[model samples]
Target: MKKTILAAMMFLLVIVPALSEETITVKGSDTMVILAQRWAEKYMQAHKDVVIQVTGGGSGTGISALINGTTDICNASRPMKPSERDKLKARYGSRGVEIKAAMDGLSVYVNESSPVTELSLQQLKGIYTGKITNWSEVGGPNARIILYGRENNSGTYVYFKDNVLEGEDYVSSMQSLPGTAAVVNAVARDKNGIGYGGAAYGKGIRELKMKKDAASPAYPPTLENIRSGDYPVSRFLYLYVRNRPTGTLKEYIDWVLGDDGQKVVTEVGYFPIR
Candidate 1:
């Protein structure tokens, strides 16, 4: 009888821990993937019973996952479109909840070898619209310009199109890469290439200082500039949920908006919303 009791005790010990553990799945926004992973790593370290899984496909992909009930949290580099919110309202009877988690500057990346340093919004529009195909047009060398950009499914892609391109179509010759990292890699390898992505991934590349127009002073995507609204392309990063969080989910979300989570944001190379 003592042996039987010991066996039962052992089984209970194993089963209890398994039952106590909780999992949260985070999906979307390649731009925010590194930041999300860091948040998860730190949060899980402090809370031993919680597990977090993070993945990045793109913000659009993440929102779709949220609508389909596949992800617990959706990270987005841009605000959700009205259509997406409408769909969520129709399906779940909730407009969903949006939490601004961090800030980022949409940086334009160029090869380190490139001589060009700054671009006005007009010049950028011309370059992306295929009207300015030569580097010399933008104060660079007399060579053909190569453009790299994110795929249509990415939130960054939509944001860029709406803001930078003014709703115009991207030039057909531009190469659409899968993620910001890939765009950065492509520009790093090609001396004449230029791409745009989140500022966090600007390592080993030159980020162009941006001017709102010819009359305005150019501003680099520094923390001060982004936070102060001096940077022309600064935007907020977001976390979205299908409904008002409850229980463990509420606690986790609250924790994420607190100081510790914002600290993780700054450490991961993005500006904290707080």
Candidate 2:
């Protein structure tokens, strides 16, 4: 009986370690959810033993998950806040790690039928803040300008608010949607509607060319324009890890930053970090 028990224990020990290779969990940023999932799928094809899971709530949710130790990685479209960094130091004894994975122009979307082909930054701010409530105010048909935006938890929302709104509040009438894709869908069907999100999400909707001011030339959110810093709203997309990544996590991140991973970024309609 003792010999049999020892043999069973030995077998269990050997099998458990082999089966327990960590499954990486990536969470956060609805904007980056599609991109992250694509990367995970392609990476998993090459690495049979590894498992990866991706989820999107928002950048804030992902950062919270990182602080609480619930996710292996957090994808964000914006930089971490100072308060968030402090929380990471308190919980993980580190300031957390940020990896820039891609670039985004943070494009503004308008319905294809809208006559307004371009807007200055101040005009965008005025439109979003309710100061310019009519499409006619910006060279469009005389109609109420319906606004669509992301939820407050979204990094895109914060970035837009900080940079475009200039710290002013969004008009109370603006409808806050759950994701960038949702914003695009809403704008695509509404002639007077306008929205803003990652450039990758502007498929059915038309991307509005933006100028620094009335005197400057309006530029589309093309890769060339973004790379040249002509697109004023361009920002980096990021991946966050609790500490210096190690083991399979490190390997996966390395793969993501490599040539093939960046190719996926371009295929997904976002600019690769390279």
Candidate 3:
């Protein structure tokens, strides 16, 4: 009887803390990971009892986690596909809730030293689709153009393919990286290399001024350009939940959409939804 009481005490000690603490798991978008971490850190500092865990594989990975009930939030650079929505409805009895967390002008990156400063939409599609393989073809030097891109499971990858490539496949020779940071690092080091990712990630690299076509004026991914629809590659960044948030989750989501959280979005180099 004494041993049974001891077992019961041990069980309470182990399970009570687990039940008392609240944890929010955010996973997905490599593009949004830095911003999400910042939000989590700031949120936790104010509410120490609530723990927020953030992870990045890719946007697609995060959506998969949401569908599978493995994560509380999925950060995605692109809107959820129709098939993903269907899966959420099948499991949760509702289409997943989407929160617009930020805006990003999907930027094209090149080494700062490269002279290729701007690209038209057609030129970009041609370069990425392998029809234009040399820098000289686009008015740069004689070097062969090297392409860096995100992997298949990335929402950035899907967005770029659908928007820039117009549903065409990427060039077979393009080097696929795991995340935007990797692509930025590659472009920073490789003078002839070009890559595409969130404008927020353009630190050591150059974010090209993009034109709708050769006939249009070129513009960088500035806030004004994006807001005015002058930036050709701008997109909304998102957080998707299995259902409409409630309890602690709803409170957290509300905070994120509030002023303080939107400020963090700009601080991390992405535009706010507002």
Off by over 4 Å in 3: 1-19
Point out the worst 10-residue segment of candidate 3 by lDDT: 12-21
| Superposition TM-score, candidate 1 onto the true structure | 0.96
RMSD of each: 1.2, 3.2, 3.2
Q: What C-alpha lDDT do the candidate models reach, one value each?
A: 0.93, 0.94, 0.94
Best by the TM-score measure: 1
Q: Itemize residue pairs with steric clashes in candidate 3.
A: none
Cα deviation at 30, candidate 2, in Å, is: 0.7
Model 2 alpha-carbon miss at residue 250, Å:
0.6
Residue 176 in model 1: lDDT: 99
TM-scores, in order shown? 0.96, 0.93, 0.93
**Regions more than 4 Å wrong, model 2:** 1-20
Q: Compared with the true structure, what per-residue lDDT tens digits does model 1 show for residues 93-128? A: 999999999999999999999999999988998999
**TM-score-based ranking:** 1, 2, 3
Q: Give candidate 1 misplaced runs (Cα > 4 Å).
A: 1-3
Span of 10 residues, lowest total lDDT, candidate 1: 247-256
